[model samples]
Target: MARFLITVVPALGHINPTMPIAEELKRRGHDIAYASGSDMQQYIENQGFRFFTAGFPSFKHYTSYALRKMFEYQGLVSNAFFFKVLIEYNRKLIVDLPPVIQAYKPDVLLVDCITHGGAQLAEVLNLPWATSHPIPGLIPSRDATPFTSWGLPPSQNPAVRACYRIIRLGQGLFYRMFDPAFNSIRASLNLPPLRHCVVTNTLSPYLILIPTCEGFEYARSDWPPQAHLIGPAPWGKVSAQDDECAWIDALPHDRQIIYVTLGTVQVFRSLDFYKTVIAALRDEGYFVVMSIGPVLDKKELEPVPEGFRIEPFVPHAKILPRCAAVIHHGGQGIAQDCIYHGLPSLVVPISQDLYEIATRCVSAGVSLKIPYPRLTPQRLRDALRKVLTDQSIRAATNSLQARFRATNAGATGATLLEQLARTKQPVYRPGSAS
Candidate 1:
């Protein structure tokens, strides 16, 4: 059996998506050991793989509710959070990562792109590593540009367009500075320079496993010979007991049901934002099933009207099929799930690569996006109304659903991982010899 070491940044976004691939490798008779924080021990071990704990300061003290609201209120770029994350990851790399590398001496290393130090560690050990991105962005190819790049075209609104250009320029500078650092790390270790496919998450070309019928990606160029759009990885299925969302179950059969959740990461931070949504939908006579996450106290918030419902958590997969539409933060996991149900969406993007996903959804004519800070009852009302009432949006979402269903997303991605492991030679670690 091939021995593989998978190192993820420990962020739920990155770690969760890679789990399916790791599990699939195990089923194929490969030996797998994944490295991440201590908290994920249950999740990783439950899948029956060996877990190696790594100390990543950035992920330390994570609060599911606080982080979720932070996204709704500030998004990923709030303050110097990204830079702070970068420093902490680098600090851990210098101290804790080397020993893990020495111990595992893996044949191949799989890392998440945002985990800067893991990439560097791969270089120091001269191991072949593949990077995974939870959201679109990172690759600079032309086809992927409109969807992933921060680069913007001049728009009719001169002021807005100028702001867009400034952001694009900054985007170029950010990558330009980092590319050299990655190359330097590789150079010092005598490994070949980073390639688009290895560093970016393009494992194959032509969207192989993504189940083209359910969802769609914008055209991309500079695809690797093997790069594909593999569909979403696995998710933990909530049990029947956990699926008790009373608000949803109690809704009258005559009222249209709408489910809104920003997810566990950033749902709590946007309390004021959610209040607006709640108020807008209250009088509209719809059955609003909202997952506030941890941001607000159930008792402290204003009393819900007879038709309204609130909960800290809800089974999204179960509720999506019963709802007329969904409203959410534009995180990929939620986006993928919403698409899977073929429900039209109103996406409010706060930060990070979410803006891109929202933009892509709008372009595809399946959803509408409202800036988080600018959210109002009217905006929420209008967005929800559009998605719920517009024939075109509903049609597009259904069409996308059909597209996604046509492919074997999980199985195809597993096949690619297995094939890559078989063909690629394990990088040699000098002191790792038995």
Candidate 2:
């Protein structure tokens, strides 16, 4: 059996999608070892894959502040904090990885596109690596024109091109800063730098996945052959716990339901924003269920007005199917889930690359983006109403949804990885095979 090393960041959004693939690989008789931090150990092991953790600074301390600061500090530091923590806390990670590389001696490596550690490790080991991006931004390609650069729309207007130029400059600065470090890591192991294809989360060619469909995408292009769009990879649904909240049970069935969540990372930080959305949705007399995620105290959010409900977490995969629309933080995971269900979205993007994804969704017409820092009840109401009542949005989303269904991400990804396993040249194990 071919052994494969799959590495990821421990964030649930990245790790969760990786789970099914890991399971599929193990089931195919490949020895799969996952490398990440402690956060996803249980979930990874639960899927029956061997877990290897490269410890990072305890985000346990930040869990309390996590939800509270959902949109705070859009600075470069905040954007790259997880990576900073991964490097600083796990000083030995660079040094410690080689032995595991030697032990497993994987035939190929699969890494989350945004994860620097995994990418560097693959480079060091000289492994043929493929990137599993939760979104479509990892690969820098031009064939996906217009939407190719950071998924932003291409324009001839001086201001827009200027903005794109600035963004590109920033992106270049960020990548160049690490080029030396990554090159050093590769040199240490006498391995060449990594050059691999980006396997995006969506089923679109231009190195971007169009989770929503053709109608939703404003700027379309023919994508690269190396870039595969596998549609939204929705994980299997698990039944909700018997002890669901009373308010959740009491929601009216007459009005179409709208599921609103800031997702786990921003739920606590955006409590006021969530409350405002609840107030607006209730005022509009719509059935609304809000997942506050785990970082907040629902009790403190007490006197939660009538016609609204709150929970620490909800099975979005289960709930999205039942909802008329979804209002979310525009996380790639949530956006994909919304697209998978063909449900329209009002993307309240907070920070970092979220604005880019949200912008793409808005440009595509399947979703509308309301800037997080500027969110208000009226804007929220207007955006939600547009997503819910706009027939064109619904029709376009439905069409995209059909295409998404036809594009079975799980099977497609499995088939590709399996093919890579078979065709890749076997690495010599010296005397070990005897």
Candidate 3:
């Protein structure tokens, strides 16, 4: 059996998707070990994998307002925030992981697409590694717009594609702007200087698995040999605990239901957005269930008006099945869940790839987009009404839902890693021209 080393950040969004694939690998008679933040040790070990952890600072929800604000702003520090964190994270892992690499000697390494620690270790130790890309558009694409495009829509037109390439150049320039900071860390670690931009350098040459379907992403022909699209991680229905379960049973069937979430990260800036949603839909005759996520304080919100509900957190699996529509910060996980359940969405962009997700979902005809800067109570209410009544959007979501459910992401990812382990060669996609 081949031994695999899987690494991830502490965030739930990244870990949740990775767990299914790692579990699948273990079930198929492979050994799985994890390298992640120390905060995640209990959860990772409980899953029965050997874990190596570093003290990754709490970027998800640190108590420091200044630190939280730095991450929330997408202007200068978004990519820098990630690069800086992973630099420190990798510096720690580099010291701790060599002994394990020498004795255990993992045949294949799987890392979160955005993380640099595991990828750096693999390069130093010369292991064949693959990355699980949670957000596919982060990689520059010819057909899809870059997240740095300021809400540009996806298109295949030559002129539009040229615009995409130009924006990609700008993105590369931004990534290069941080070369000094990245190179300093690399020099200390005794790694060679990067030959390309940060995003290009971090990507594995052997395999890069995207946890999304082709139908969901904009059609692109220029993806590299290592890139492949596996469908979203399949999720079983989650049963809520006692009070929440009874409350779900009690939700009224008389009116249309809508699910809302700001996701887990960057929630510190979401109060105004949440307040606007509450004001818009509270008395609108629809039942609105808003999952404020764990980072926000409900005491800070204005008291809930009748017909609206506020939750600390709700599993998307539990609420999407009971709703006619969803309103969310355009995260890939929630967007995939909404599509998998065949529900139209009003995507609200807070920052980063959210705008790209909103744009792609709109391009796919499954969603509508409203940036936080443009969102108003009236606009949100009207958008919700249109999404609920729009036959075209519903049809697209239902059509894509079938495609999303047909493929098993865990199995596809495991097989690709298995192939990489056995051959130590680039695992070109089955039908890829690249």
Candidate 4:
């Protein structure tokens, strides 16, 4: 049996997708251990894997920092603040990981794409490692619009192609601002300076797995040789007692059910958005089950509308199957879950990779995208109406769901990781079958 070491940032979006792969590897008799923040210890242990604190600060610390600094600056300066926090956090991990590696003696390392230190550690240790991107659009491609542009639909028009080139140039200019900080970390570790952009630089030379299918993402012919488009890995906790959520069962079958969430991180910034959504959908005669996230108090959103039920937390795995549609922040975890269950979505992206995911949903014809600046009560209501009534959207969602369901992403990822462990090399090429 091969021994595996998995590393991830403390956020649920990054940690949860890795769970299914870890479970599959364990079921195959491999030993698995995860290094992350102490906050995730219970969740990791519950998944039947050994959990080790990576000796980094909690995610709350960074979130607090962001909250304090976000209003102080805008544009590039604001972006730099977030990146600096991640870099410092990863620095801590780099300092702490060597001891874990020496003790665990893992055969292969599974690194989260966003864990800056894990990629560097893998190189410093010279171990067989693969990067897992829970979200796509991080890896750049020449065949499609720049990932930062939010996955705009591809066009053969020369004007559109030229616009894409200009966008890529702007993206490069923005990324170069961090070269000194990123390279300083590399130089301190006796590593070479990166020749590529930050996102591509984090990729493993051995393999990179994305939990998405081709149908749901833009077609890219320029993906790296190490990249593999594994379908979405099904995950998340399921509520055990149906009786606990029996209110869902009691909701009248007459109206369509809509699951609403802005994801864990963005939900804190979306109180006004939530209020607007509730007001928009209230009179529409639809059932809206909205997860306001744990950080927010339910009392803040008191005087809840007639058709709305608000909770601090609810497992999407249970509620998604019952919903006719989903409204969320375009987080890859819940977005992919909606697609997996054949539920249409209306994505309102706040920031980060969310815009890209939301745009992809639009390109795939399974959802509509509403940028934060353009969000209005009427627009939200209209989007919901379209998502619920559009036969084409329903058909597209079902078609993509069929394709996603046919593939066992968990098994496929496990098998690929096993090959890497046994051979110490990537066995599957980009776009090849597992």
Candidate 5:
């Protein structure tokens, strides 16, 4: 058995997805250790893995519902937030990660796709490594438009492809402005030069395991040979208590239950957004359970609507099985879970690559998309009703769920990583089972 070290982006969304693969490797008699912030130590040790402290500066949480207007233009010319994340993560890891390597001396390094310096650290140390990615479609592609506030689904038509190419030219021009910044960081460690920040900084040349299935993404032939679209690596099941079942059972049988969560990362979602949801679905004869996340107070949104329940947070595994529909912000975890469970959705994207995911889900006919600019009580109400009663959407979701279930992504990805550590070569092969 080989020793493996896991470095993630230090967020719930990124860390949670990698757990399954790490656990699978451990189950096969491999030693596993994770490097991240101090707060995550207990959680990691509880899962039976060694933990290393590699603290990063916490980002100042956004108070506005969307990006500041001045930064909105970056969406047109470049993916500002994504690149900023890559640069920010790299600067920190360059300082904090080296000692961890000295201590662990792992045979293989598995890192989150957006954790920039981990790949560079592997290169500096001359160790085998792979990327455990939670989201796909971030790589700029001619097959699909650039990820922005406005993005297009993938297309084969010449006109659509040409339009996307033109848009990419603008993004490229903006990306070049950061050449000095990226090169300075690379030069400090004697690393190879790179042109694009996202491509060079994050993607591993050896192997990349994207947990979503190929069917969920636009078909692309141009990905690096190491990249594989493995199905989602969700957490193990959460046992439901008798009290939890009883609480769910108490909901009126006459009304269909709806689960609403905007995710935990962005606390900037305004009071207006929740107010709009309550206004639209109030007394609509449906039971709505909404998770407001950790930051907001339920008392702030006083006089909650009838048949509406509010909480700081609730596990998706507990509430999803009982819901007839889901309304989310298009994060990869919830998106995969919705497809896996065959539930229809209404996706309202606020920032980052979420707009791309929401648009792709719309293209697949499994959900309806509403951008922040177009959000309103009437629009949300209408979209929710359509996703709830639309049989075609249900059929489409179920069909895709079957495709997701057909592959064992966790086991498949585990086998590939094992091959990487053992052979120290590219793990993907043409016509090999993924």
Candidate 6:
């Protein structure tokens, strides 16, 4: 049995997808250990994996800084500050990983794509590592628009293609902001400067495991040979206590259920959005089940509307199957859950790869994307109505659900990691090719 070490940023979105893979590995008689923030220690240990705190600040600190800066700053300044903080966070993880590796002596390292430090450390140590993308692959390609371009719809129109090219050029300029600090960190680790953009450079050329399938994603021919398209590896908690989920059972059975969440990161800034949703659906004959995330107090949303139920958290695995539709921040985890459960979605993407995923969902015909800036109560209500009544969206969701279910992503990921452990081959030498 091979020993595996999984490292991720502290966020639930990054950590959750790894659970199913880790469980499958353990089931196959492999030992698994997780290195992350201290806040996740209980959650990791609860899954029966050994947990090692990666010596980073609590999740609260990271989220607080992100939330404050995301609202406080604007344009290039906000973007620069976000990357600078992210790089510094990754630096801490890089410093903390050696000791964890020495203690765990893992045969292979599974690093989250966002955790650049872990990815770099894996290379520095010459360990077999596989980069795990909980979201869509960010690798640049000619087959599709750059991920940063909000994943604009692919087309044969020359004008559109030219615009995409211009966007790519602009994206390259934006990436240069991080070049000094990114290269400086690599230099400190005795690694060469990165040739690819920062996002793609973090990928392991040996294996890039994405928890999505071709049916739900844009076709891409330019992906590296090492890239693997495994289906959604979904993992979630379901409370055993009936009382914990009794609220779900009590919802009015006459109305269709709509599951709403802005995801953990965006939830802090979503109060206004939530209020708007509540107002939109106040008498729309739909039952809305909204998860506000634990960071926000439910009391903040005073005078809760009728036909709605709000909670700090709810198990999507248990509730999504019964829902008629999903309205969310286009987070990969929740987006995959919607696909897995065959639910059409209204996606309001705020930041990061969300816009990309939202774009893909729209292209796939299983969702409607409403850019956050354009999201008004009427727009949200209209989008939700379309998702619910559109037969094409339902059919597309059904098609993709079949595809997602056909592939056992957890098993596929486990098998690949095991193979890498056995073969001990490094597919791409770091910095050899951009």
Q: What's the lDDT for residue 224 in model 3? A: 78
Clashing pairs in 6: none
The total of clashing pairs for model 4 equals 0
Residue runs of model 1 more than 4 Å from their true location after superposition: 43-50, 55-84, 101-105, 146-170, 177-215, 234-254, 294-305, 425-434
Question: How far does residue 81 in candidate 5 sit from its true spot (Å)?
Answer: 4.4
List ranges where model 6 is wrong by over 4 Å.
Answer: 55-59, 63-67, 71-79, 149-151, 236-243, 426-434
Candidate 4: stretches off by over 4 Å: 55-58, 64-79, 149-151, 236-252, 430-434
RMSD of 5: 3.2
In order, what lDDT does every prediction score? 0.62, 0.62, 0.78, 0.80, 0.77, 0.80
TM-score of 3: 0.89
- lDDT by residue (137-166, candidate 1, tens digit) is 444543334332222322357676566556
Cα lDDT of candidate 4 equals 0.80
TM-score, per-candidate, Cα-based: 0.76, 0.78, 0.89, 0.92, 0.90, 0.92
lDDT of 5 by residue, 167-231 (tens): 77876777776766777888899987788766557788789888887667777767666888878
Better of 2 and 4 by TM-score: 4
Tens digits of per-residue lDDT for model 3, 343-404: 99999988767777888889889999888778999999999999999999989998999999
lDDT minimum window of 10 residues, candidate 3: 234-243
Q: Considering summed lDDT, which 10 consecutive residues are worst modelled in model 2?
A: 197-206
Better of 1 and 3 by lDDT: 3
State how far residue 25 of model 4 sits from its true place (Å).
0.8
State the TM-score for model 6: 0.92
Stretches of model 3 off by over 4 angstroms after superposition: 38-52, 55-57, 63-105, 142-144, 237-246, 431-434
Error of 5 at 148 (Å): 3.9
Error of 5 at 264 (Å): 1.6
